[model samples]
Target: MALFEIDESSGLPVWVQLRNRFVYLIKTGHYQPGDQLPSVRTLAAEAAINYNTVSKVYVNLESDGYVESVRGRGVFVRDIGGKADDVRSIADTEIEGCIRRCLALGMTIDEVTLRMMDVAHRLKDEKS
Candidate 1:
């Protein structure tokens, strides 16, 4: 089975849904630099997704510079890039995702603010 689960009802496109999970594996340090990813055929079979879809995901990952495909060695993780501009782009995406979920949960501005602060502090503590 795949390392992540998909929610078909989440209103996200299949590729997007898979992409987010796939990227998380990289971003979270689960897949280290030079670590090979599962073969496309293997991932496709595990996720029960189309082979084409898996190919598309790999292509995007390569285009984004997050991974590379060696001729016969399969795909491997690239050292993740985190330039200032890239950080900002990722932060914007994260903010939008958080806001959408908070809104859907009917959270008040004050509640969201507090929750954000609490989570931020907890994360900072964990890092320290």
Candidate 2:
């Protein structure tokens, strides 16, 4: 599967979906600091989305301090530093990304909820 996927049917706007996915990847360590992200045009073409949409996402990511775009170079993930205070926000972003993925894969909300509950229970058990 591609690193970036879009769900047109999702209630979330395309830019929002893209933004949340980017944050989730960064926070999860899938995108390490200094790792270069795809150029706006490249990612737009790859995701079959509009250039402006990708551009907006990249701009927002940069503003959020998740990445830095070096002129003539490319967008690279930033060392946002100290994830402690960001734990809640990161968790929310991840949950949203997971639900979006499940919906894109044709899972109903009920199915997603059940799966999530099961996973949560398993995680809680592991912590015991």
Candidate 3:
């Protein structure tokens, strides 16, 4: 599977997308503590993003305590105490945004909830 993807049509900034994906990977244990992340240039090439943009994301991730960069070494994931609250907060914000967008499109809460659950199940099945 591809390590990263960029949705040009999502309207989200490229750096934000890369940062969020790194956060999700760290929170999901996909990249364990002390695991070295790909170098900025490598990730930029892999994700087809600008090298500067990837570097900015790395800086932001480091500031947020999700990662650390060692001199002469690459960035690595930080433990951050598992920080479930932080992860949950990020997810909550995205979920709320999606709900608001759906509501603005005239979808009821029930419809959004049902559709979200259906998609979740479908994705789970696909993964299996």
Candidate 4:
């Protein structure tokens, strides 16, 4: 199982954080179609979070067509075609929010761009 790190200090809610992590895994091919995910209880225990929190994240993913739940079995990754566009939109929205916040903080566009690049590099390194 892949481990996910949750930043309690981040502005995003825990459930959102969990959901985004799963999305990232799926997008990166860490999780593949028909692959079964750990049960909500197991995932919560491993993540050290509430079971309901994990459940809610899985439920939201299912509703978004990224995953499907099987009776008596766990959740499995679904063959969600065109999910890249959805992921891209979510990423664009997040970037826009960050840019807005940086502008509000009186940061120059160049400075914000540099910072974004630095953060992107760090994220790429972490993933590798």
For this target, which candidate reaches the highest TM-score against the unseen true structure? 3
Cα lDDT tens digits for candidate 3, 51-122 = 999999999999998899998998988887847467778789999999999999999999999999999999
Which residue runs does candidate 2 get wrong by more than 4 Å? 84-128
Cα lDDT for residue 93, candidate 4 = 100
Candidate 2, residues 59-102, lDDT tens digits: the string is 99999999999999999999977653465676789999999999
Say which prediction, candidate 1 or candidate 2, comes out ahead on TM-score: 2
lDDT of 4 at 119: 97
* Predicted structure 4: lDDT: 0.87
- Write the residue-wise lDDT of candidate 4 on 1-128 in tens digits: 24787776689999999999999878767788999988999889988989899999999999998899999988999987656567677889999999999999999999999999999999766755
Runs with alpha carbons beyond 4 Å of true place in candidate 1: 81-128
Clashes of 1: 0
Q: lDDT (CA) for every model shown?
A: 0.82, 0.89, 0.87, 0.87
Candidate 2, position 1, lDDT: 55
Worst 10 residues of 1 by lDDT: 80-89
RMSD values, in order shown: 7.7, 10.1, 5.1, 4.9
Query: What TM-score, computed on C-alpha atoms, does each candidate reach?
Result: 0.64, 0.67, 0.69, 0.67
lDDT of 2 at 5: 77
For model 2, what is the C-alpha lDDT against the true structure?
0.89
